[model samples]
Target: MKRGIVFIATLMMLGSCGIFLPRPEFEKGMTERRFLRQNRDAKISNLDNGKTTYRVDRGERFFVLATFEDGKLVKLEERESRPNWMTPQEDPEKRNR
Candidate 1:
C-alpha cells in the first residue's frame, strides 16, 4: 500500500510539472531555415534589409505570421477571423516606421 501511494504521488507531481514547463512553440530567435524546413507549405515573402516573413494558414479562419532578420526569427504574430457579422474591415496602424 505504501509503494502504491508513493507511485501515485510521483505520477501526480510529474504530471503537474508539465503545466509549468515551457514548451518550444512559437518562440522568437529560432532559426529561420529550420522553421521553413519544418513548415514547408508556409508562404514566404522577402523583404528589404535582410528581413523575411513567413505566413502559415492554420485553417480557414486563422493564420500565423513570423518574421526573421539576418536568418533568425525575430517576431511572431497570429490572426484569427471572426464571424461575418462581427468582422471588422480596417487596416491596423503600421509599426517600425
Candidate 2:
C-alpha cells in the first residue's frame, strides 16, 4: 500500500512539472518588445532557451540586447551598449571623423 502511494505521488509530481513549465518558442529582439512592455515590473533582463526577455530600469527606460542562436533569441543580455568591438560600423559618423 505504501509503495502504491509513493508511485501515485511520484506520478502526480511528474505530471505537474509539465503543467507549470514554460513552452519553448523562438523569439527575436524586436519581438520581445511586447513582452518587455507588458512586464515592465519584474522584467526579465535575460532569457534563454528561445524565449522573450525584458530589461527593466528604475527610470522606466532600459536597454536590451537579444542574443540569438540559429536566428532565434536564445538569450538576452542587458547593457548600456552593444558588447565588444567598437568600430566605425557601429557609428557611421566615426568613419567620417
Candidate 3:
C-alpha cells in the first residue's frame, strides 16, 4: 500500500509541474527564416516596415497570427478565419469516416 501511495503521489507531482511551465509561442529572437523553416505552410504577409504577419492554421480552422519585427518574433495572437465565397479553407483535424 505504501509503494502504491508513493507512486500516485509522484505522478501527481509530475502532472502538476507541467501546468506551471512556461509555453512560449516561439522562442525569443526567432528570426523570420527560422520561423518559416519551422512552419513551412504558414502564409506570410508584410504588415509594415520591419514587421510581418504569419498566418498558420493550427487546427479546427484556428488560425494564429505570429507577428515579427526586425526579423524577430514579437507577438502571438489568435486570428479567426471567416469562410467567404472566394476564400479557401483548410480541413479540420478529424475527418468523417
Candidate 4:
C-alpha cells in the first residue's frame, strides 16, 4: 500500500509539469498605445530600426518578448532565462564575488 501511494504521488507530480499557460491579451496588430494602456507596467525598448521590443517578466525563469513594428505588435515569443557562468545568479548584485 505504501509503495502504491508513493507511485501515485510521483505520477501526480510529473503529470502537473505540463500546466497550461493562459493566452495573453496582447495580440498581433495591437496598437502600441492600446498595449501600453493594458499593461501599464510593461518594460519596453526602442530599437534603431523603428522596431520595439517589449519584455514581459513573470518573475520566473520563463518570460515573453513581444516585438513591434510600425507601432503595431508584429511578433511575440516565449523565452527561458538561463544564467551564464560569468553571472551564475539572476541578480548581478547578489552574485558571489
Tell me the TM-score of each prediction against the true structure.
0.57, 0.28, 0.52, 0.56
In model 4, pairs of residues that clash are none
Name every residue pair that clashes in candidate 1. none
How much lDDT does each candidate structure score?
A: 0.82, 0.54, 0.81, 0.81
Tens-digit per-residue lDDT, 1-97, candidate 2? 9999999999999998998876443244434444444445645545567643455443433465455444434565555653446543556877688
Clashes by residue pair, model 2: none
* TM-score for candidate 2, residues paired by index: 0.28
Error of 2 at 30 (Å): 9.9
C-alpha root-mean-square deviation, each candidate: 9.5, 10.2, 12.5, 14.2
The number of residue pairs in model 4 that clash at the backbone is: 0
How well is each residue in 1-97 modelled by candidate 4, as lDDT tens digits? 9999999999999888768665468789999888887777678755758998988776758777888899999998988887565465467766755
- Count of clashes in candidate 2: 0
Off by more than 4 A, model 4: 1-24, 83-97
- Highest-scoring model, TM-score: 1
Model 3 gets an lDDT of 0.81
After aligning candidate 4 to the native by TM-score, how far in Å is the CA of 77 from where it should be? 0.8
lDDT accuracy of residue 62 in candidate 1: 87
Q: Scored by Cα lDDT, where does model 1 land?
A: 0.82
What is the per-residue lDDT of model 3 for residues 10-95, given as tens digits with 9 covering 90 to 100?
99999999999966547767888988888898997557776899888978557888889888888888877665665865567545
Q: Given candidate 1, what's the lDDT at residue 65?
A: 84
Per-residue lDDT value at 75 in model 1 = 87
Q: Can you rank all candidates by lDDT, best first? A: 1, 3, 4, 2
